[model samples]
Every structure is written in C-alpha cells, then in structure tokens.
Target: MKHTYAPIGLYSLCKPLLFRIPPEKAHKLSLRALGLAGSLPPARYVLKRFFSPDTQSLSLFGHTFINRIGMAAGYDKNAQALDGLEGMGFGHIEVGTITPKPQKGNPNPRVHRLPQESALVNRLGFPNDGLDIIAKRIESYCNRRNKRYSGPRPILGINIGKNKTTANAQAYLDYKECFTRLKDVADYITINVSSPNTPNLRALQSEEELEKILTPILDIRQKSASHVPILVKLSPNLEHNTRTGMIQKLVEWSVDGVILSNTTKTSHPWEGGKSGAPLHDATLSLIQETRSRFPNLVIIASGGIGLDGDLQTFIEAGADLIQIWTALVYRGPYLLRRL
Candidate 1:
C-alpha cells in the first residue's frame, strides 16, 4: 500500500517564507526549482524515488495512468515543469490554457492567497507561451525522457483556450488551431471554456456556441490517424439546467470526458474565480450528478481537493480522476503520497 504520511517537515519550514513572496512569483520560482532539478538525471531520479506514488494502475483513453491524481492545467501553463512535476509523482500533468498566440495574462497581483481558507483567487487570464512554443517544449520534454528513462512517466494533457483578442464568433478557429498543433504530443486535450477571468469565454458553454467549437474539432479527430481524448473543463458556477444541457450535448457529440469544474466566481474583494476548500461541495455535487446521469462518461473532478479525506470523498462521489492545484500550494508535494 502507498504511504499515508504527509511529509511536511521541510515544506512546513519553507511554506511561510515562500508565502511571503507574491503568489505568481513564488509559483514561477517553485516551477523553476523543479525544472532545474528535472534537468539533472541524478536529481530527477532521486526526486522520483522519493515522491512517486505506488498505486494501482488505471487505463483510460488508451493510456495508463499510474495513479488517479493529476496536476491541473493552470499551474504549469507553459508546459515548462513537466519533467520535474512528473518526478514528483503525479500520474498525469496537464499543461496550458494555452492560446493560439502568446499573450500576457491579467496584470500583476493577479493571484492572491487566502491562508486561512487555503484558497486562491486568480485573474491570471491564461498567460502562456502560446501554442507553438509550448508544443515544442512538450515535444522536446517527451523526446528527452523517452531517450533517457524507460519507466512510466506522467500522462500529458494539453488544455487549450482562445486568445483574449479573439471574438466569440471566431473562437472555434483558435481551438481548432491548438487542437491540430497539440494533438500529436498530448495524451488528451481539454477545452477550457470555464475560466472566469476570460471575458465571454464562458459564453462558449452554451450548447449552440459549443457545437460550433466541437464540430470541426470532432471532424479532425475522425479524420486523423491518431486519437486523442477530448475533454471540456467547466465552471463550477454553471446553473443546474445549463450544466446538464451542456453535458447532454457533450454526450451526443461523443466527446471523451468532462472536468467537473474549474473554479467559483465567488471571489469577494477580488475579481477572479475562487478555488480550494470552498469549491469542494460544488465539485462533489457536480460529480455525483453527472455520474448518476451519465454512467459511462469519464469524470475528472478538479477543485477543492487538498486533504486525504477530500481525495477519497471525491472518488466515492464518482470522480474517475482528480486534479489538484490549490492543495499543492497549501500542503506541498507531500500531499501526493499522503493521498
């Protein structure tokens, strides 16, 4: 069995100091540390040995996931930390909210930490290195690892979104471009229509607008020799009827899966979406409702998953997979093995 002990010693010592820095800067620093460690073979091995989860394997979408846990999309937005993150024991590492063109996201002081709530409110509007550069990064990362390590590595999921400059009518072009460019390197692709920071991006969740986005993408999927599972990340604040209607449309279109939620729009004294403990109830409710309604649809539950109890509760509520972001901020890498 996997160890349940949370390794908090060093992280506890470092948390306060790290927290003292601005959230986004701290985030970049953390990823840079891991990226540096990953670039060295000996360091990568040691990190992997210490942090890797020993869990039963799961097969989904023609790939093997070594564990149920994945690092969610927004954290590694540019795909820069894949090797280091994989070394730290996530069964999957999702990157991006990447757009067709490189763009600066929301301005600084965008990501705020709520230490007491263990939550984050970010309007970091999909800041990324764009599709072309990130795709090469992923491709290069996979190539380097394939040549060096023969053991299991984390599954790569590329999450794509439209550029801020793109109008709602032309959004499908951006998604199509990203899907086409990224399909080769990705084990799966997630369509991000749910981030509250992006204006009118959530508007695509409407059945009519969504069909516009999916039709061409599905056509490409059918024609391509390779198959990549496509998933949609949704907002937690979606109304009952709207959410259900969207899922039903996803089913009809034969989309592969759905990420139960992104974050909540309940950011008070802030302008972005809220994540962490506050999102747990909504995520759980969405997973149960979706599972009960569509027994076979793949459900990747994200939001408010930090503790061991939260992990178990989500799975029990019918989450086929779980992704973590805020939890990593609050609890550190040790939370992976603890779960």
Candidate 2:
C-alpha cells in the first residue's frame, strides 16, 4: 500500500481559483484553511510529513529552533495560527508587526500580487488586534502545549511595530507595551522599523532616533526577571553604508539579533516592495556587509529567499537563520518542506 499527500496538489490546483479572488481575501482563505487543517490530526500528520524539515537543530539567542526556516511576520498578524503553521514544518513562526492598540491599517487593496514576478506588495500598515489581545492568544497557545500534535513545536518570534496613528515621540511606549505583554510567551522579539507604509516610520532607523527608542527598550528587557532576546528588522532599500551603520548601532545597543533586509520599496518592473528574485542581490549584499562588521550578531535573512539556492546564498552570506513570506505565497508550503 502507498500513502498519498493531496493537499499540496489540491492547493496548487485551487491556487488559480483563489487568485481569481482579491489577493487579501485569498490570503485570509488560505490562513483559514491552514488553521482548520492543522486542527485535524490525520491531516496535520500528512502535512508534517510533507512540509516539515528533518535537519540539524540550531541555537540562537539562547533558544533552540527545530530548523533554520521560519515564517516571517505579517502572516499570522494576531498570533492565531501558529500551531497550524508549525504543523506545516516551519521551525520558527514570527507573528505580528503588532502595535499597542488595535489599528485598522491602510485600507482595502493594501495587498497586491504580481504573478509575473512571483512577488507581493503589501502596505498593510501593521493592522493588528493590539498587544493585549495578541498576548492573551500567545498565552493560550502556550497553555495548550501539553496537547498532542503531529510534530515538534515551532519557535515563536513576535515582531512589534508602532501603531500607524501613534506619534513618533511616543513610539517607544507602544513597543514597551507590547514587549511587556508578550515577553513571557514569545521566544524572541523583533523590533520592526522597516515597513514603508506607515508615515515617518522608517525615520526611526536613524542613529539618533534609534538610540532613543532602543535605549529604553533595552533597559526594560535587562530589568525584567525573565530576559527575552531582541532582534531588529532592517530595510533593504537603505544604502549599504547606512545599513552597516545600523548594524553597528545594534551591536552597540546590545541587541540580541538582526533580521537582515525587510521588503524592498524599489519597484522596478513590479509594484510594492520588490521581493523574491528581484531582491536577491541587495539582500545578499546587505547581509554580507552586516556579517563582516558584526560577526557575532544573530542574522535572520528575510528578503528574496524563495528557493534553496537563495537560502544557500544567505547562509554563505553569513546569515544564522532565514525567513520567507513572499516565497510561501508564491511557491506554497512545499518550499518549507523542501528547505
């Protein structure tokens, strides 16, 4: 007798049908399906076999991840579907670019797909269910850890961002709020300052501003009885020198890790931030430059990683871990399994 895995095939067949709908709607539907499928024991086992990676373990920031492959933030905005995602073989799942308060985000049509380029453009503005809600969800998920599951639990990385409407001067407060709430449950925290959708958000990446924001956050983390690792997400569009300087600042601040290159805002042939194939060069360059300067820093490469070759490039470029969101959208869950 032979066993068959049909969901991936079915998903490939149904993708065109899903694509006919709005991109965001398709995304929500996919997420819903993942959540439902994960809840089912038999289906989850099949998915784990098909998508999960059997690889050597990795140690970073004092925690061990099942594998180097992780789901980038923005997929599970409210931390709702982590178990489902883990069931699909992601070693680490980063949820949310969450804010202190609930926000509606930019508007409809914020997420656009470019099938020709196998990429996506999103200006979601970090809309989330707020830090309090996200914290509760994570706590609940952790509480259910004793329950049986198909595979090992995935590491949870919570990515925090300022609310779109929040004032820049008050941004630290928002980040602190989320950190305080999610610290106990999150395996790590990613301080996101790279998204281009929010007004004046990227400005925080500057040395002067970043110092002010990070100093207090770092203090809070140090003072806490439970210490959680912190990583900062950087933009790929910044000049190489600027990116290097940011890395240096991160090292000086004693940040635990760095996510090299978020979505690129440069729109050459495609709209939105150029991801996938287009971002490979810039992302690789940034990673290499940062690695050269800060060899000890934990580097999680994010941009342009869609294939094994791209993953190899990042690893060679000195990345400690790798993440993919656009690739998962373009290539489906099989990419995780393959990696």
Candidate 3:
C-alpha cells in the first residue's frame, strides 16, 4: 500500500489570513509562495522524499500516469507555478484555458467565495498570458526536464481556447494554433468548449460548432504531432442529448477522452459558474452517464471532489481520473498530501 502523508494543517491555519484579502490577490500570493517553495532546494528535496508519490501507474491514451489526481486547468491559468504545484504532490497538472491572445477577462470581484455552500462563483473568463509567452515558457520547461529528468514525467495537459474576441467560425484556428505551437510540450491536449464565461463558447459544444473545432485538429495529426492524445472538457449544465451528441462527435473524431466539467451557470441563489462542493453529484452523474454510453471513452471527473470518499465514489463510478480545484481552497494544501 502507498504511504499517505499527514496533514500539516497549514492552509487551515493560514486560510483566515488569506481569506481576509480578496480571493484573486490571495490566489496570487499563494502562487508566488508556492513558486518560491518549489524553487528551493531544501523544500523540493524534502517534499520529494516525504510525499514519494505511489507508483500507482495508469496506462491510458498511450501514456503512463503515475497517479490519477491532477490539478485542474483553471488554477494555474498562466502556468507560472508549475514547479510549486509539482512540489505540492499532484501527479499531473493541466494548465490553462489559454487563448490565442492575452485577454483581460471580466473585471474584479470575479472570484466570489460562498463559505456556506463551499463554492466559488467566477466570471473570470480565460484571462491568460496568451499563446506566445505561455507556449515559450512551457516549451523551455519541457526542454529542461527532458534534458535532465529520468523518472516518469508528470502528465502535462495543455487546455486551449479561443480569444473571447474571436468569433465563432474562426475559433477553430485559435485552438489549432495553440495545439500546433505547443504540441511538442503537451503530453496531452484538451479542447475547452465549455467555459461559461466565454460568450457563446458552449455553443461550440453543439454538433455544428464542435465539428468545426475538432475536425481540423485531427486532420493535421498525422502530419503534425500524431501521438499527443486529445481530450475535451465539457460543461456540467449540458442536457442529456447534447452530452450524448458531443460524445458521438468525439468518437468520430478519434478524440481520446473527456474532462466531465468546467463550472456551472446557476440561478436563484447562485451566479456565474459555480464550482467546488455544489458540483460534486452532478459531475459524478455525468461521468457515470458518459461512461455507460461510451465504455471506451476516457473520463476525468472534475467538480466538488475534496475527500477520500469523494475520490472513491468517482473512481468506482468509472472515472479514470478526478480533478479538483475548490476543495484545495476549502481543504487547503494538506488536502493534496492526504490524497
């Protein structure tokens, strides 16, 4: 059996101090500290030995993953804290919903915490550093690791999106550009068609629009990076038929898998895309549904997962992997160690 680390209760203790500040700023501060910690020789050495991630490898999509828990895309939108994230013990880190260009996203107060519900509402959109810079940053990182590393490489998944200003018909090009530009660095790539904050983005999930985005990428795979597996991230709010239709298209396109959610747009009491605890049951159901309909399709469940019970439920419900974001906020860094 794999040895589990003890919770340090660091985030539990510091959260009050962190939460006092705005959510966005607190996130920045945490990212910076994580980067500093990841860069430190002592911190990295100690963490590497302490956690010693179990060699629980999963062979899928032509790659072997040492562990199933991964840090989802949104948290490290710009890929700045990867070293720190790696130090925190995630076996894989999916970075970005990056666009072809840098976007300012929605204005402040975007990330709202609902402590009572254990959720976060955000309309931050895809506010990333754009293709040129991020692609360069990761390409260099991949090159360095490739040159020096020997052990299994953490699965690096790049999630790509179109610029908010980019119109529908042209969005395919944006995704293709990012995929082509970062192909060498990405162990796998995700097509993000479900961010609620991006105007008409979910429309891309529809059969007509989804084909435009997915078809071209596969068209170029043979002449391009043929082996990099591709997956799609779907929205939790999708209707049953819409979900089934999307999966059918993925099967046609030879897409590798699906990440069962990106937050949900709710009403009455909630606003924006609601993530964390509130999204748990819905995500698991989607995973079960998608798995039943398409047995071979790879499913990575994302949403309200934050505990061992939650993880077990997802894994047993046919989830190949489960990704978490909000629980880390509610449960803290110790959550990663515990997993």
Candidate 4:
C-alpha cells in the first residue's frame, strides 16, 4: 500500500481548519496552494499517487481524455492554476465563463453553503480576467507543455458569456468577441446561457433566441481551419418539453457536445443557485432526456453529484463524462480517489 492513510488523514486533520474560514476565502486559499504546489514535483508525485485514477484513458469526440473525470468550470475562471491542477489528476479542466471584457462579478456574500443539503449555492456571476488575458495564459502553457500536463494540454475548454452590461439582443456579439480571441487556444468552446445570476442570461436558452446566437458562432466555427469543438451549457429548470426541444436543436446545429447543466436558481434556506444534493434528481432527468434525444452527441454531466454511486447514475443516464464542484469543496482534494 502506498500509504493510503496519509492523504485522507491529512485531509481529516485539515478539514476543520479549512471549514472554519469563510467559504470563498477558503476557496481562494486552496487555489493559491494548488498554484504553488504545481512547481513542486515531489509533492505532486505523492498527491498523484494517492488521488489519481488507476486507468487514465477515455475516448470522446475522437479525442482521448487522460481520464474520464474533469474539474468543471468555476473552479478556474481565470486559467490561473492549470499546471498545478493537472498534477492533481483531472482528465480535463474547463476554464472560464469568461466574457469579452474584464468584469467584476456580482458582489460577494455571493456564495453560500448548505450543510443540511450537502450542497452549495453560488451567484458568482462569471467573474473572470477576460478572454484576452486568459488566451495568453493558455498559449503560454501550451508553449511550455510537459508530460505532467497530459492530453492536448489538458483540453483547454473556454466557456463564454455576455458582459453584465450587454443587452440580451446583442449577446451573440459578445460571444463572438470571446470566440474570436480564444478559438486558437480552446480545444472546445461552451456557450454559457444558463447562469442564474446574470440578468436575462437564461433567456438565450429559448429556441428562437438560441438559434440567433448559435447560428453565427457555428458559422464562424465551421469556416475556421481549426474546427474546434463547440458545446452549450444548459439549465435544469426548464420543463421537459423545452429541454427536449433544446436537444433537438443542438442535434440539428451539430453542436460538438452538451454540458447537461449549469447551477439552478432554486431557493433553499441558503441563498444562490442550488448545487450538489438538491440538484441530483433534476440533473439526472435532463441527462436522461438529452441522451435519448441525441444518442451520438457527447454529454458532460454536472450538478448535485457527491458520492461514488452518483457517478453510476450519471453514466447510466448517458453522460460520457461527469463533473463535480460542490463535492470537491465538501470532500476535499481526495474526491477523485473516492470515485
């Protein structure tokens, strides 16, 4: 045994200390630690041995993923910790729900924890360092690529959104600006129309509105030599009929993939969009429905997943890959090991 007890014991010892701090502050501190650890190979070796999956190969979109699990978006909105994160063992990491221009997202006290539900509620509003800054960082990583940073520089997936001030009618242009700057760096792109905190952001999910926004991006993507994959992040709050309609449209547009959900605006006793336990049933339904509608489209599932058994539910519902955020917060870095 490669000292199995050590990592979990360390996490148990440190858990109370981390939980004592404010959730957002603790999150920032965790990312900083990861960034520092990125430069220490011996530390990474120990961490990887303890947490990384035994089998590290998955095929999707004709590309091989170093593993099946990925760190969902929101963990790295600014692409600041890619090297360190890769060392820790995520098959891929999606960075940003970044906008065309830099933005200060919704004011804090924006994230909340619901221990009762084993969940989280966040209205972080896509705070990011903008596409220009993010693109440069990704290109820099690509230039200095190493074996530790496996599988196409760990599949840089850019998630785009409209600026807080942008009108709903012009949201497509905002996505265009981000795509134009980021296409070269992004292995795949996710058009985010599901964030609950941004005003009218979810309206773009409507079929007529979605076509207006997606049509141009698809045209641009098709014309490009890179032919980078494109995906859409959807909301789980929609009625069954609407969700089915959206899947049909995604197939018709030939989108490269679909992220089954973003967080939802369901109000529990805690404020913000509910994620983790409460989202489990609804998210599964969305995945099951979408999979039935588009058997061939790659589906990346997220929302409300906590335990090892939850992974099987998502897989059975037709998710090609699964993502976890709240569980990572509550379960510590040893999450992948448990899975």
Candidate 5:
C-alpha cells in the first residue's frame, strides 16, 4: 500500500498548542480526535496509511505483535482511542487500569507536566468506565474485523485494578470479576497492584497478598477453554528483595509476563508517581536485574521511554516489549514512527 506521509514538523508545530491545554483536558481532547478519526472510514484509511510504521514483528504469548512498542495503560483507560492509536503504529494498545465499577478518580489537575524533565506525575488513580462498559467497547472494536484495515493488528491488553472503596482483603474479588468479564475481549490481562495513588494498592504486591489475588484468577484461567496471558505490574520503588520475592511468586504460579517498573515516587518532588526521561535509568536497571534472575520470563518494560535509543536500551536490557506513556505525551504520535 502506498503511504501518504504527514507534513514534516507537524507535531513540533502543534506541541505548543497541546501544551497550552491542561494535561487531562488535552488528553481527553486528543483521544476524542483519535476516536472520531478512527470511527470514520475515510479518516481511518488516511490515518493508517500515513502513520503505520514499518513492520517489525515479534511473537509472544502465542500472538504476533507488529512492532515492539506498545501504548501503556492509563492513556486510554476506556479503550476509546485504540483504532487511531493502532493506526499511529503502536504494536499494541493496553487500555485501562479498570475496576469493578465506575469511578471519578482523583480531582482535576491530577496530571502534571514537567516540560524540562520530559516527564509526567499523575495521581489519577484508576478512574475508568468500569468492567462492563470497557469490555463491550473492546468487543465492539474487535468485532469490526482486522481485514478492513491494512497492516498487522495491534494486540489489546486490559489492565485491571480494585475500586478505591474495596478493602485489601476483598481486592481479589474485584480483580476476579474484572478478569472474568474482560478475558474474552482481552488478548492479555495485567493485574495492576502497583499504582502509588491507590490507597494500599501497592500492598498487594507482597508475595502472600499476590498469591491470594492470583490464585483465583489463575484458577479461572485454568478452567477456561482459552488461555489468556496474565501479567503483574510492579512498582519502581520496590526494594531489591521485595521485587525479587514477588517475581518468585509469579514464577511459581507460571504467570505469563511481568511489566517492570511502573512510575516512581522517588524520582521527583511531585506528590505522584513520575514517568519520563528520569525513569529510564531506574527502569533499565529493573529490567536488567529481573532478566538476570528470571532468564526465561517475558518482561514488558514501561517508564522513561522517549527516543529510539531508549527503545534499543530496553531491548538490550532483555525487555521482551516496551511501553510508552509519558514519552508519547512529550513527543507526540510521531514518536512511534521514530521508534
């Protein structure tokens, strides 16, 4: 297929305007635009042709990803922007840190930009449209069929979390419900137990607590006719022994993958977890150590990825795949092409 290139310096020219909007508002606006373009046939065609990256594929978890870069969760917590984002050349789009029920998340001004740092600190919690609606949205989008569009389809993963109102002991029920509801639609499922903003959520990262959580989910996966990969997302702030202990539990349960190093609380003075250029070194270290200890484990690296060099660094560090959230915000959609 012939491609129509976007005009040079398009995002550079638009960066100032995007920066002028409040971070959360600008995020919603961009998702709306992408959703609109993705919903319309002509616009979808133009987008796919213009932004599709050169095919660089890999196989994992019994699926082939067209590229190594994925859009991390929280960017499209409701799955509203998959088509446009997929068109923009991401190998996969992981949506939601979804809970059992809808939530308002934290108040406004929860997402802050550190332009000089090329980073973002977010305390948005896990606000989303809940399991039922989000699952349906994904199902409807998947039902559209990939044949209508060119290029390999991007893999879809759903990240699940507990509602803020749920107690730590009851959190497994929330995760189980989300997994039971979303598994059919999701290519993979990520259990998010590491978001710093969620009260006591990170406590679930403990081996004992994680076993309570993963047991039921793994039981269900065992019973189901289909096997969907289940991954755990770990906080970047974990001490060495704590992190490795968690991984040992994961191995014991035979979980499919691990997303190393979510946003960090120590990297900046901000009140929330930070992601961007500052996160690269710590994340890379996590990837290296985790890879060394668990040679065969599938590791998805997130945090602090921006340039092509960062991509190479993660890959060299033994990351099976890399995810971009803050970098996408800083560099624009064109970042995918550059990667």
Candidate 6:
C-alpha cells in the first residue's frame, strides 16, 4: 500500500470552496471523496498526509485506536464512509443512530449552521438507511478490509436508536432489532437516547427506562456469546443527581462504557440539538463528574470541542476517548491536524 502524498498546503486552498456549498452538501462531497480515497492506497496516503498523521495508537473497548480523536455518529449515519474516515486518520468512527427501518428523519431545514458561534443546530431525527442496510455495509467493511489488515484496526462503533414512530412502550424492540444486526460487526455499540429531535426520546434516559432498553441488548450479547463493548450515549441536560444515578446504573449493569453526551437541547440562541464550541465547558464538567463516580467506566467525551487544545483538556479530565462533529464542519480538515 503506497500513496502519492498530497502537499500539506492543498486542504487550506480547498476550504473556501467547501464552505461555499451548503454545509450538508459539502459534507456529502467530502465523504464521497474520502470514500474513494480510502480504497486507493495512494489517495488514502495523500489524504492522511494532509492531516499530518499521528503515530500513536491507544487501546480501548478490546481494540486499539490509531489516535484518540474519533468522528462522531451523525457524520456517517449510514456506515458508508468508514474507509474515508479511516483514511483521514480518525482513531475511530461511529456510524448511525440506526433504527429498525429507514426514515426521512425531520423535515428539510433540519440542519443549520451558526458561523458566529462555531456551532450547529440539527433536528435530523435519526435519518438513516436503517439497520439492515447499515449492517450489511459493516459486514462488507469487516470482511473486505478489516480482515486483511494486520496493522492497528481503526475502532468501529455502531450507534443504535429507535424510530420516530415507535412508541416508547416498544422502543426496546427497535433497539434489539438493530443491536442483533450490528453486534457481530461492531467493535462497540452505542445506545443513543439523547437526541432532542425525537419526541419523548429523552425520557428513555431515566434509569428505569434506560435499564429496560439496555438489559435486553445485554441479553442478546450474552445469548450470542459476544463480548462487544456496549455504551450508552447521554444528554448533557440531565440534572446532576439524575446523571450520576444513570452512571451508577450503567456501572451496576456492567455496561462497557458511556458517551459523555449527544448534542444539547438548551435554548442557546439556536434551535434543535446544539453542538460545537458552545458545548465545550458543559461537556468537560459532565465528563469530570462521570469519571469521579465511575473511575473504570470508559468515557467517550463529545460535545462542544472545536479547537485542538480541547481534546487534551478532555483527555486530561479523565476521558478515555474523544469524538468530533461540528468542529470539522467549522474548522475544515486542518483542525484534526492540531490534535
């Protein structure tokens, strides 16, 4: 595997052009380009070179990451861009809040950019190609590329959730459907109950509700004889005691890890789930609190971390791993280089 490396200066030159397009549209183009480059050694090399590849690999969730930085779930909702994300040298990549069936998510204008705050508000109610489709892609990724790689495999996590129409009474079925499909292929699994876009979805964050959802998925793992790490994604808005209770339950339940947060639901001069620079301080506080309570629990910190220094700050605050979303969109490809 050899590469025709791109000069380090190319990405900065392309930043203005990417920003000119709609943010979502630009995101799509970047995914496609990275997807193509991922299959070709030279192109992948060039792509990684532009980000100034980090040589360190850290172990977590029974797998080793090429670095601590990871791309969060919403970035590649359908599992289509793992190769490309890996090409860019993300230590890990999470795809999907995949549901039992495909959905249109929220209506258009569902995602908006706030350049002034380096933040974004998205009401994309888990729009994805669903479990079956995403599962197949993961299966293909594992069989085709993951098997042959002798080097460190970029950690892969499948993030799962219920559909918008599914009643809360039966949400566990949607989660089970996705978990059963993805468990075999995923290095880790994330139960996403924090997104503000779906009605009543946050209710699942309660300890009783969360246990109802996670216990069954844990059962599936037991039944299948798998030890894949299972993690719960949390909302940043939970009251401190409520959040601590949830972490205690996760520890008691013997779950593998917890994602510090999904996007926030606060009214911060924007609508929908607020992410990016605005989430930095709140996320750190939450991670610190969570780590204090459950010292051994794997904490994947995510939220308002846009600058490179934020990664170190979170890591020092007891986070084992970190994820990024709005930052890539606002800071362009160069941002990850600093990490």
TM-score of each: 0.96, 0.92, 0.94, 0.93, 0.94, 0.93
What is candidate 4's lDDT per residue for 78-156, written digit by digit as tens? 8877777877778878988899888988898888877656677888888888878888988887666654443343566
Q: For candidate 5, report its TM-score.
A: 0.94
Can you rank all candidates by TM-score, best first?
Answer: 1, 5, 3, 6, 4, 2
Query: Against the true structure, whose lDDT is highest?
Result: 1
Return the lDDT, model 3, position 223: 75
Give stretches of model 1 more than 4 Å off.
1-7
Candidate-wise lDDT, in order: 0.88, 0.80, 0.82, 0.80, 0.86, 0.83
In model 4, which residue pairs have backbone atoms overlapping below 3 Å? 276-304
Which window of ten consecutive residues has the lowest lDDT sum in model 6? 1-10
Worst 10 residues of 3 by lDDT: 1-10
- Candidate 2 residue spans exceeding 4 A from truth: 1-11, 149-152, 266-272
Which scores greater on lDDT, model 2 or model 3?
A: 3
Question: Model 3 residue 273 lDDT?
Answer: 88
- Per residue, candidate 6 scores C-alpha lDDT tens digits across 1-339 of 111112134555786687688767877887887788778888878867787356578877678888888899899998887877887888889998899999989877677777667778888899998788788888898776756577776789889999999999999999988888888788899999999999999999898998899888888898887788999999998888998888899889989999989998855565689888878887888888788878899999998765657678898899998998887776666677765
Error of 6 at 7 (Å): 17
Candidate 4 ranges beyond 4 A from true positions: 1-9, 146-153
lDDT of 1 by residue, 1-339 (tens): 111223264788888899899999999999999999988879888887877777767998889998899999899999888889988889898999999999999888899987767788999999998998999999999999899768877899999999999999999999999999998889999999999998999989899999999999999999999989999999888889999999999999999999988988855878898888777776788899889999999999998877676667888899889999988888788777776
Clashing pairs for model 5 are none
Q: Give every collision pair in model 3.
A: none
Candidate 2, residues 99-196, lDDT tens digits: the string is 99899988787788777666678877888898888888888777765466445568899999998878999888888788878887888999999998
Compose the digit string of candidate 3's lDDT tens values, residues 1-339.
111112246656777787799888988888887777777868866666665445577888988887888899899888887777776667789999889899999888788887777778888989999999998878776776666567776789999999989998899999999988877778899999999898888888888887888777877776773578899998988888988987898888888999988998865364578887777777877888788889998999998887655666898898998887888877777675565
